[model samples]
Every structure is written in C-alpha cells, then in structure tokens.
Target: MTDAIKAIILGIIEGLTEFLPVSSTGHLVLAGDLLKFEGDTAVTFKIVIQLGAVLAVLLLYWKKYLHIGVNMLKMDFAKSKGLNAIHMFLAMIPALIVYLFFKDMIKTHLFGPEPVLIGLVAGAILMIFAARSRGTKTADTVDHLNYKQAFGIGLFQCLALWPGFSRSGSTISGGLLLGTSQKAAADFTFLISVPVMFGASLLDLYDSWDLLNSDALTLMLIGFVTSFVVALIEVVTFIKLIKRLRLEWFALYRFVIAALFYVIVIL
Candidate 1:
C-alpha cells in the first residue's frame, strides 16, 4: 500500500480503539508489524496520532473544560459546580508518579507482543468482572464522584502503563468497581486521559525528534488528521454505548484479540 493508505489505516485503528476498552497501542504494534511499518518514526507516529483522540475530547467537552479553567482562576474549586481543575489534576497524579519513575523501564522491557498479550487478557478479565459486578446504586455522573473515587480510578489507570492494558479499560472498570455508573466511569476515564496522553506524546516526540523527515512528517500529518476525524465519531458512539451499559462487548473483544495474538505471534 501507499504511505497515505498506510497512514489512513493506522489512523482508523487508533481512532476506533483509543477510547474503547481495546488496546490501541497493541493493535497498532501488531498492525504495523503485519504491514511492514517499523522503526522510531513509526513509534513517534503512533504516539502523535493520539492527539486526535485528545482533540476530540477537547472539542466534545470544551464548555465543561473551559468552565473548569475559569473556575480555577477564580479559586472556585467546588465539585458541585462541575468537575473542577484541582480534582482533575488530582486524578492525574498517580499515573504521573508511575510514569515519571518507570516509563523508560516499561518502554524497554514491556513494549512487545508477549507483555501486550498478558495485559490484554488481564484487562479483559477485569472489565468483565467490573461490568457484571456493577451495583445499581452508583454515582451517576462524573460530577457526582468524590475525590477519593477519582483517586481510585487514577490508581487503576496505572494498570494501563502496560501497553495492552488499555487506559480507558482500566479506568472505566475501576470506576464500575468503585460504584460509578458506566457512563460516569467512562466519562471520567476520558476526561482524565487528556493530560496524560498529551504529556506522553510530547515526551515521545522529543525523544524521536531525529526520526522526522519529510516523508515521515507527511505520514504523521495524514494519520493525525484521519485519527482526529475518526476519533470524534467514535467517542460520540462510545458515549452512547456506555449509556446503554454495554461495555461487556468490549471485554469479549479484548479476549478475542488476546487469543489471536497468542495464536499468531506466540505460537
């Protein structure tokens, strides 16, 4: 395939799986292997394309984020008004701590098919149990969650430090286990991902700065724009799916993908 086609295909995969419980990085790695896309530039492309999903979140919830920022400036840090900036920052602390300390270790040791397979299976099981065990009386929205619950979700997000663990999967499952409705859990999960993904992407870009040539930059732009448009659509659809309490389907998907990886790559 042409470079443009390759970029579009990878962008579609990123957009489709980024917010879902499936592992977007795992999928991208596997797809790149199959398609003969490799090296530092490809890695940087994958990381940068995630900006698409982050931008989708920003566009989708600009009003809420803007309000949170304005409130922060006025020192009106009340959860009752909406999701405040302080608590959102608090929710990000655990992942930040983990990343600061062990990011290089993880990248060196676990960014491979075997670890991804393990993470996929483990994350799938967690999602299944969380979905099945959800209580009827739960926090119904992101604004209803206390700082403790948000912190718990952040801790759970640490599970996603592994490539195939799926950050949204870990956080949403954590949310359900902590007595939040599916929609609420999913909402908070997406909201919290904004800063984490951005920081990681920036770091990756800085590390891979030498790999960007004209062709690679063009491929990155194609993937970036494609993922942005596709992620916008997928995020909306995912919200509707969460509202209907249908996250178990993603558990099944993770299981199937994990099994496929074991069969095709590890056998």
Candidate 2:
C-alpha cells in the first residue's frame, strides 16, 4: 500500500485500540504483515500515528487536565485534583524508566511479530482472569483514588511496553482489580495514556532522526489529526458506555484475536 493509505489504517487502529487494551501496536504489526509494509518507515509510521489517538484522549479530558494546570498557580494544587495528577506522574515513573532503557530494543525487536504474538496471547489470557473479578466498587471521579492504588495502577501501566500487553488495558485492569470502579479505572487509564504516549512518540522521533522525511512526516501529521478527532468522540462515548457495559466483550475480543493470530502465525 501507499504511504497515505498506510497512515489512514494506522490512525484508525491507533484510535480504536489505543484505549481499548487490545493493543494498537499489535494490530498494526498484523496490519503491517498483511499489507506487506516493510522497513523502518513502516515502524516509524506506526509509532508516530499514535500521536493522533493520544491527542484525542487529551482533548476529551482537556477540562480535567486543564483544571490541574489552572489550579497549580493558586497554591491550591494539593487540593485533590492536583494530587490525582501527581499520582499519574508517579505511575508514569516505571514506564518512563523502562522506555528510556529499552526503547530501542522495543522499537526494533519487541514490536515485531514474534514477541508481539506471544504478548497478545499472554495478555488475552490475563484479561480473561481480570474479567472474572467483576470488581464491585465505583468512583464517579479521580478524587476517590488513594496513593497506594495509583502506584499499583502505574506499575500495571508498565506492562503495556511488552507489545501485546496494552498500556490502557493492563493499567485499567490493575485498577479494577484494586477495586476502583471500572469507570474510574478506565478514566485514569485514559488520562495517563496521553503523557506516556507523548513521551514515547518523542522518543521515537529522536531515534528516527534523519530517517524522518517530508513524506513520512506529512503522513504522520495526517494520522495524528485523524486519531485525535476520532479519539475525542470515543472517549466521550466511552465514559457514557462504561456505566452500562462490562469489560467481558473486550476480554472475549482479545481472546479471539489472540487465538486467531496464534494459529496463523505462531502455531
């Protein structure tokens, strides 16, 4: 496929799966194989395109995120909301460490098919167990989370770096297991993704260096715009939808996709 079509496909996958825990990177790996997209350009496309989806999550939660910024000036930053943002930053620590240390290996080796397929099946299996919990708590907003809980969730977020183990999926599941209401877990997961993804995209660009050119950069911009707009819609819808829905369907989807990929590629 041409670069434009590749960018569009990458953006759609990034938007849809970025928050779902189904692993957009994993799907993009599969898509790459199917489309016969080879070379580092394909890898760069996949990584840069995610900026779109992360932008979407940021836009949707802009009010909450912005509130923290405005409050920071008032010395009232410690008043609940700022604390939540602090927790998010805390949770980001481990993944940031991992990213700095192993990001190159991740880009070239981890995101490739073999390790990714293993991660997908492993994450799918874990989600099945996580789904069985059907966590029985609820929180309407971020204020309800405790420091310990935030730390725990942050540790879980680190799992997403493994390729098939999605950052949102693993972190949210970790929150649910710790008894945060599903919405809160999902919300925190979404909020946290923006910084983590932004950090990652920047890292990718730093490594991409002279490899990034006008055409690839343009496609990435297109992908980013597309993902950002769609992600905003999905986040708003996700907030409303989570109240009524169970994560079981997503768990099942992961399992089915894992099984299909395992058979096709690994087995």
Candidate 3:
C-alpha cells in the first residue's frame, strides 16, 4: 500500500479507538509498529493527527460550547444551560500538570507496547469495577456533576498519561466509580478532552515543526482528514453505544487485545 493508504488505515484506527474505553494511543502504537511506521516521523504523525480527533469533539459539541462562551461573555453562568465551560477547564488541570512535567520522560521510556500492556490491564480492571456498580446510584447527566466531581475526574485522567490507560476510559470509569451515569461520564470526558488534545497536538506540532516537508505534509493531511471524518462517526456512535451497552464489553475487548499485544511485544 501507498504511504497515504497506510496513513488512512492508521487514521481509522485512531478514530475508532480514541473515544472508546479502548486506548487510541495503544492501538496507534501497535498498528503503526505493524505497519512499520516507527521513528520520529511516525511519532510526529501520531501526535499531530490527534488534532483531527479533537476537531471531531469540537464539531460535535459546538452548540454546547457556544452556549458556554456566550454565557461567559455575558457573565451569566446560569444561562449557559447545562454546559459549564469552567467545569471543563477545571477537569483539564491535573492532566495538564502531569503532561508538562513528564511528557518527555513518557515519550522516551514508556511509549511502547510493554507499558501499554500494563496500562491496558490496569485500566481494564478499573472499567470492570466501575461497570459492576453502574446504574445503582449515579448522576443522571453531565449537568449534575459538581466542581469536586469534575476535579476528581481530572485526577483520574492523569492515568491516561500512561498510553494504553486511555483518557476516556480513565475519566468515564472514574465517573462511574464516582456515581455519574455512563452518558454523563462520556459527555464530560468528551468535553474535557477538547482542550487537552488540542494543546497536546499543538505542542507536538511545535516540537516537530521541522519534519513538515511536502511529502510528509501530504501524508499528515490525509491522516488528519481521515481521522476527522472517522472520529466524527465514532464519537456519535460511541455515545449511543454507551447508552445501550455495558462498558464491561469494551473492557473485555481491551483485555483480549492487550494480551495479544503483550505476547507480540514480548516474543
């Protein structure tokens, strides 16, 4: 296959796994390695193209964001309806601090299949625990989550710094454990993800600015657009899936994938 085709495939994998309890970074790492997309350029491609997934979130939640923006401008938090921008900002704090201090360490030492395997299993356990106790006592929706809960979710999001742990998985599982409904957890997860992903992508772009030559740029564009479209579809479908299916299904899927990759990496 052509480089562009490979990029498309990776983009699809990214979109499909980004928001689910399954890890986007883990899938991308495994798929990229399988496709021989290693080295600096491949890493840059993976990090930069995440903007596409962030765009999907922005597009999907534009109305809610706009409401928050307008209300903030008018100094009327109550009029923002159920979408509070401050809550999302607060939820991003812990991850931001963790990423800034340890991003290089993480990229150098832990951005591999081994750490990913451990993270996958650890995160899966959390998902299973949360799934077992879902629905008995939970906040009905995102609007019901207080600042403390949002901050608590942010702390949980720090686990996603460990690649396969997954941002959505960590936050959603945290929400479930904290008594938030699945849909609410998902909504909050998606909301907080927008800023964090965008910031991380920007940092990656700045760090890898010299790598953006013509051919590389073309591949990046293809990957970006492909991921955007695919993520748009997946983001919508995942919300529906959360409403219909148990999160343990995703956790179980992660377990199988992690075990498979564990053997592949070790052997």
Q: Against the true structure, whose lDDT is highest?
A: 3
For residue 202, model 3's alpha carbon misses the true position, in angstroms, by 0.5
What residue runs in model 3 are displaced by over 4 Å at the alpha carbon? 78-81, 134-138
Deviation in Å, model 2, residue 235 alpha carbon? 2.5
**RMSD to native for every prediction?**
1.8, 2.3, 1.8
- Score each candidate by Cα lDDT: 0.84, 0.76, 0.84
TM-score between candidate 1 and the true structure: 0.93
User: Of the candidates numbered 2 and 3, which has the greater lDDT value?
Assistant: 3
Candidate 1: tens digits of C-alpha lDDT, residues 192-255: 8788898888877777788888999899989989999999999887677755656678878888
Q: List runs of model 1 lying over 4 Å from the truth.
A: 134-138
How does residue 79 of candidate 3 score in lDDT?
52
Please write out the lDDT profile of model 3 over residues 1-267, one tens digit for every residue: 678899999999988888888889988888887787877778878877888999999998998778777777887765555657678877988988898888878777777778888888999999899888736544778888877778889999999989889999999888888888888888889888889988877877787788779998898899899899999998887778855578788889999998897777668
Q: Which portions of model 2 miss their true places by more than 4 Å?
A: 75-77, 81-83, 134-140, 242-244, 265-267
* Clashing residue pairs, backbone N/CA/C < 3 A, model 2: 52-228
Instruction: Encode model 2's per-residue lDDT on 124-183: one tens digit a residue.
Output: 766666767866664445677777778888888878888888877788678878778777
TM values, all candidates: 0.93, 0.90, 0.93
